[model samples]
Target: MGKWLGMCAVVAAAVLTSGAASAQSGFPSKPVHIYVPYSAGGAVDILARTLGEVVSKQWGQGVVIENRPGAGGVVASQALAGSAPDGHTLIVVASGHATNPFLYEKLPYDTFKDFTPITLLASSPNILLVKADSPFKTLADMIAQARAKPGSLAFGHAGNGTSTHLAGELLKGLAKIDINAIPYKGGVPAINDLLGGQIPMSFNNGPESVGQLQAGAVRALAVTTASRASFLPDVPSMAETVPGYDTEVWWGLLGPAGMPADLVEKLAHDFVAALNTDQMKARLTKLGASPIGSTPQQFDQKIHADYEKWGPIIKAAGMKAE
Candidate 1:
């Protein structure tokens, strides 16, 4: 009887191990959720919906999006950190995900340990926009005025600690000016205020500002990237004016930490596949975004690199969450 029981125990262990392996291999046994830490129609939200369509078709399951926009992505990030580490739940986070740690006194979750990067979806240079008929004619002119007036000139950003906000701060640091920085709950409000002449200028991503630029409502002084955006080639890059200025907003996929290695691999591969499709590439290009399908390791390294790069900037600027 003892010999028979021992054999049964060994068989059960192997079966359980096989079951666990099979479960992970199968992946997305149910519907998947990709959280967006911004309001609808924003860059991250748009990319999530686009990729969700492709991935859902591949998985034959719904890819629901939940938009929890506030506190510079803290609200949604905390929710993602609390979710099960299973492959079903993920967040489409912006580059602000890396900067939050430096902007906030404390975060609800560990930025590195509480998340797993899948792959970066897209990136766009923040456009430096002023009203079409504004007096400042060139990048040099704008800097000169800001230098002359100091705190009299102000710019609007999406929110505190966001890429747009940081871009504005970077300009201050690099140009050695005293332009007041304003934070809005969303980019739309800031752009609206700019149109209303409440703020002299604003930093908005390509997607949000493209229509305004097309309508001749705003003029582009320079794009925050080191290179001119493909969609706006006539516009010069900030580095062309500020010498070392370079800032671009990026979005990526991240799941709750502790997801199985195989599951993470599959997610990254599947997302990269979706991003590489010709249809997706064209669609994103129309929105002034560039598709970037990086490996899981590459995406992880990107977060760490940005975190290191932006930490000192945020600290020196004395920025904090509102």
Candidate 2:
């Protein structure tokens, strides 16, 4: 009887190991769902749909993009956190994902603990823009005016805790200037106000500002990156005046926590592969974004780094979500 029981135990162990292997190798056994935490036609939604199309073709599985826009991405984030650890469910998150914990008093899920980083998909620089006829021809002109008048100069941004808002704040901190930050419901409204002369300047992402730039309705004073953006080569970087300034609107992929390491690796490999295609590269460039298919480890590090980098800035700025 003892010999028979030992043999049965060994057989069960082998079966369990084989099942695990099969599960890992057969990722997305069903249709994959990608939740976008913003409204359609937005940058995050566009990115999700664009990538989903390529990934679906590669995996031979349907990729569904569900937009759950609200509460600074908490709604969709909570949904992702509750999903199975299998690679079938994922979310495309923005840079705001890293700063939400600091902006809100409470979140439904833990930022780092509730998700597995898949990859950093793409990024676009924020442009400090003014009307073409505005007096601020250069970043230095804006900084000088801010210093001369103190709080008299103001810049508009998409919303509180957004990448554009943070870009403006980072400028204030590094330049030691007091420029009031005005928040709008969306980037469109902010840019509209800038053009209408309701705001002197606005910080907008590359996609949001590109049309106005090409039409010559708006002028780019500086891009909020350490170096000049490839899409707007003529625009100088903020770091030219404030040596340490750097910020951009970035997006990445994440899945529910507790995903198997091998599954994460598989998802990362497939998604990175999809992102590297010539089609995806050209599409991203048209949207004024640069494709960045970073490894899981690198994406995780970015989240942690941004979390640390923005916590104090959010707190110091006294920003909170309504």
Candidate 3:
């Protein structure tokens, strides 16, 4: 009886090992779906499509990008949470993903518990921009003016919980200046308003602001990163004026919770491989984004860090959404 039991145990172990290998090897048995929590043509959607193209080629499978923009990402996140943990369904979330829990009164899914982070695909700094003809040539100049007339200066941002809005708030807190924040439906509208002279300045992501900057239609006062962006080296970093100010718009890949460890690892490896390719590198640089392609563990840590860092700020600002 003892020998029979030992043989059964050995067979069971072999079957388990084979099952794990099969799961990893047979991913994307059908078309893979990646959900973008924003509208098409936006940075997140662009990045997803760009990366998906490379990943699909690598996997010999079709990648479908679905845009489900609403509630600052809740709509898509809810869909992801309800998906099977087989790695077929995934999402590309932005920096707002970390702060959404704090922005909304109640979320449809738990931020940390409902998903498995696959990798941080890329990051880009937000730029403080004004029309080319505006008088604020530098970040210091803008701060000086805001100090001179408290609340007289206002800056447009994509939305209340977006990275651009947070960048403006960080500037206000660190620069010790009073500036009103004007929320727009999206970044393009904010940039349009700035260009139309309706708003004096706006906070926009690197991807969206690069065109205007290159056209000389807008002047970038500072990039909201600890250091200057490689693509916009001429622009000063906000840290140069407001020491310690650092924030960025980052996007990461995630699947629904309960993904098997081996499957998660396989997905991360494939995605990171795609990100490291020369084609992806050039594409990301043109988009004004820096590719990260961090491991699952690293992505999880970043998400937690951002969640902790932004929760208090959101609370203090009294930012809440229905």
Cα lDDT tens digits, model 2, 1-322, are 1122224334333322332343376667899999999999988898899999998998889999999999889999999999999888999999999999988888999999999998777888999999999988898988898899999989999999999999999999999999999999989999999999999999999888888999999999998878888888888888888998888888999999999888877777777777777888887887888877666787898899999999999999999975
Would you list the clashing residue pairs of candidate 1? none
Cα misplacement distance, residue 211 of candidate 3 (Å): 0.6
Cα lDDT of all candidates, in order?
Answer: 0.84, 0.86, 0.86
Hey, what RMSD does candidate 3 come out at?
9.6
Give the runs in model 3 whose Cα sits over 4 Å from its true position: 1-23
| Model 1 stretches with alpha carbons more than 4 Å out | 1-23
Report the lDDT tens digits of candidate 3 across residue range 144-217: 98999998999999988889988988888888999999999889999999999999999999899999999999
Q: TM-scores across all candidates?
A: 0.89, 0.92, 0.92
Per-residue CA lDDT of candidate 1, range 167-193, in tens?
Answer: 998999899999998999878899999
Q: RMSD of each candidate? A: 11.1, 10.5, 9.6
lDDT of 3 at 302: 83
Summed backbone clashes in each candidate are 0, 0, 0
